[model samples]
Target: MHNDCIFAIQLYFMQPVTGFSKLSKSQKIDWLVTNHLNDNATARETLTQYWNEDQKLQDLHDGFSENTVTNYYFPFGLAPNFKIDGQLVTIPMAIEESSVVAAASKAAKFWMDRGGFKTVIKGTKKVGQVHLMYHGLSSEMDAFYAFAKAELLQSLEQINASMKKRGGGIVSLDLIDKTKNLKGYYQLHATFETKDAMGANFINTTLEQLATTFRLKASQFDGFSSDVPEVIMSILSNYVPECVVNVSVSCKIDEIGTINGVTGKEFARKFVQAVDIATVEPYRAVTHNKGIMNGIDAVVIATGNDFRAVEAGVHAYAARDGQYRSLTKARVENDTFIFEADFPLALGTVGGLTSLHPLSKLALQILENPSAEHLMKVTAVAGLAQNFAALHSLVTTGIQAGHMKMHLVNMLEQIGATDVEKDLLRKEYADKTPSFSALRESLLVLRS
Candidate 1:
């Protein structure tokens, strides 16, 4: 009995506390500092200090995810002077990166004088799959699927009524045969058009309903006498290559004029070469695409869409053609220097956090409540514009000149420089490249 009690005590010491999430917000923080954090004083304030000033807003933030602690904040800023589809629009961006918003705004202003961005909605088709396991003959499986296809569509009529009424619904359904590769694997691949909603819930709910109906109907089919097809899982696919948008910006090479001493013709040549490197090299492509997504994801988050989903779908599209490649392409044609890109985005203007989060509601209002396609265009433009700015720097003044200059502000804040100290340091680094060590030394000397 003594040995068992000792064993229980050992397990108690080893295991994490159960009911952490069950604790109240204050109690949770108390337990966190007492059990997990070594620096009680610093951890307590650091964790709780960013709490929303409004109690109602804080409560709303706490409900966004599990373990109600404190809200981690991101800077919400705007990039103005974007003329997309002949309308001037200011994009809202939520990010911690110091230069992303500024870079986007610079690019927007540069192109705003040219022709702005022109975007075309290529398609808006999202994909989902109902994976199945059937140990029956391929021919038998095919026949069963043929019968089940129409039935599956009929079964989801109620679920798709509203989506269809909105001019969006199931586009196509096909039976993908994969028996040879996985012994007994097949899929009921489906396509959908969700219109102005991201439609994750709609697609998933419909797929699950279809999966249930498909499983139940197996008994009615003679093709599966004893080899009943098992529904493995039904879920949406983020690899949405068909849901694509194309955005481009162009100007006469001569009208591009001079930038930072480089002639327009020379800049265009070097710019196209930089894009070519990213197109052929995976290492460059990843970073190149990441720059584009910096802008895409910032606006995506600001508008309360799922940036993770947007990211997944986008990266998948980048690697769709066997190797990873750049999303943006550039060239000189007819004395016109053109930079363009294709983005596969599945974003919604409503539902989820759009209506729930106060900031998300404001973001949509700022866009004047765009439709899903319009949002896709603007989001693509943000990415394209961001890529343009990054490449522009890469070809001309070097990325760090502007990037490190912007990062100097962060360095000042990090070293706890006063307003006066920051003002002095800012002027000093206006035309100089500032380093972290240099900033710390400068602050120390200023104080001395």
Candidate 2:
């Protein structure tokens, strides 16, 4: 017999299976191990290693999306003692990066007695666009827009009724002419107040409906009777400049006291200078903003909000004035040190994964079930506090000292150090620079 036929005969005798997707969960695992893996017992053991002890909980997790797979976990940490807008709030952060949570907590505690963090929600308007192409004259496009605008808004009444009851829906729509920039290209700009929801689905639904209404209405209007506007696409924009939050921390220069061996006044001047450099230098601003997002994204993920969208919007806002600059600003006036950051943040507390994920639900509960507005304030404060902590380190004892100290534990774990070895290495690297390769070599020498 051919080799394939012989192999198939052996496989069939070992384990015969068909209709894989229709198999039960246990059966599927059996088939997976028997047919696909060389070491069936080890594969079975490894697959089950990460499953939750509670079958129901594991089933619920498996039901989160198609295809059953094990859960992936990140460290969920809490940064306590955050005083935001006079409320003592403990922020939950989920991240795998070392020292981010520690840095945020340290900054929050440092400013806790120095007036804490203050925040304000400047606006809460999210946007969407219906891109169009009109080869006709500009006046015809203008006329078509003027005539179609009311009908477009009226068409969304049924769709927006439920949202409107909750004090959120289509707020405004405008016809923006982009012929100057691109030939025969224009946009129907729509803005919304989604309230407690991120409203991606809502905005897209509304825009699609508007685009449909515009195309239908334009065909009948005399202005576009010959040339109907072509709808290219309808989607929501992640860049929400109108949705913004401002967070700040201020203290008397004398209250700054000492940090990392630098005196209060000297620290204040250096802090201002560092911020000034970021404002002018894109190279520094990129890292500066990254540090701020480390704190922001941690809180955002913990609450089940979209961190990618927030990151995109905040970075776009940073470069709004033609040059990318520092998100955090520091200034010294009359012996008083002030630091603040203002950036666009569109977040939700009611919809999306917040209600679905158990950890997210618990995180929201731990945050005292804040409203969307309140969450925005808290998230902004987290970013501000993180930036402050990073700057404090950058200007004083330098970024590496504290960063490496926190990283030492990770290094030890990476080199397979035992409890005794970890303890010994911790003391050895107490005042020395910690490096992964060096620690690994030291452990090898000690073992020898």
Candidate 3:
């Protein structure tokens, strides 16, 4: 009978709960705890602990996503002393990684006296596409697309009315044929100037409308009476290579200053060598580029832009030359140290989470409420600063010393060390590397 009862309870929990989404927050938490958490009251308390004391604010956060339970938090840090384009700005970064904010901060101050980062906006035209298929003569399709170009663009005027008033709208809309690659595939490649908006929704909406107009017009066109092109999909492409920003930082080689007892010229030579290795070797390039993104992504997230989309677009841009290489370049010419980077950053200063999240609003405020172009320049500078810090550490006292030193406090907390014990161990391991096991043993010695 006891075994039978155990089977009944297991079977009961195995059955899926109906209308789970419709359940109240309290009911959902209760159900979760009862069914999966082994009735642990602490699990329920953990969820409630992260809730805001202000009910209205808590509700706003909950509505950001579906089936929301609790707010997952990240440390919001500021890296000050960033001078970009003759203006000083403190960048807001949201991340949990150790030593990232510190590295960026150090790099910013390191360059402040030498020369601040210089940034230029290369282009801001974003791209989208409408894909279609039609088993028809290539010549006929080409002529028909040419005829429809004006109408396709005109159809966007109403949709882009507000954007037009803001000096942003359609840049170009043209048909691209890909019949050789796919038997009947074609695309209506479109570009737009989104100005201060990231413009994913704007681009996608424009493409879908264009697709609708094209299919309707194709049904009536003389060349397509027999076979109208079939609309497959309309979406915005994250691979906006044309939308780019250029970031560069340079100063006299001799003025780079001594580092870890190495002369400025020697450090410059080693730094250029390290960047060169990453440029040619794929294995090292991946990590090198990742370090750059660590800075870019942190700012992107803190400002509430789509970091995932930025990541996808950035990695694609890196491999655009048919090979993955470091996104940054370094060279010493005429006794001057030069470093530069160019990459796409489709960021926005408005809309999405920027208008919704409180912290995101603060990030923009900290940035002095920059326009999209300025935001791009600021973010690219962050990436450059982060890379410089990493490479400087690599060619200096090494990465582990500072990185592990930053991790010491966390290690002490994990082992439940007292405040006094942590301070003592911190000094002892300040110049030395430590592992968890070694820390544990030493911790025991302190107690003994």
Clashes of each: 0, 0, 0
Candidate 1 global TM-score:
0.95
Error of 3 at 226 (Å): 5.7
lDDT (Cα, tens digit) per residue for candidate 1, span 43-67: 9998889998899889999889998
Count of backbone collisions in candidate 2: 0
- Collision count of model 3: 0
| Model 3 C-alpha RMSD to native | 2.4
lDDT, candidate 1, residue 235? 99
Q: Candidate 2's residue-wise lDDT over 182-212, tens digit each?
A: 9999999999999999899999999999989
TM-score of each candidate structure, all chains considered together = 0.95, 0.90, 0.95
lDDT scores for all predictions? 0.92, 0.89, 0.91
Which ten-residue region of model 1 has the weakest summed lDDT?
3-12
Candidate 3: the clashing residue pairs are: none
| Model 2 per-residue lDDT at 203 | 96
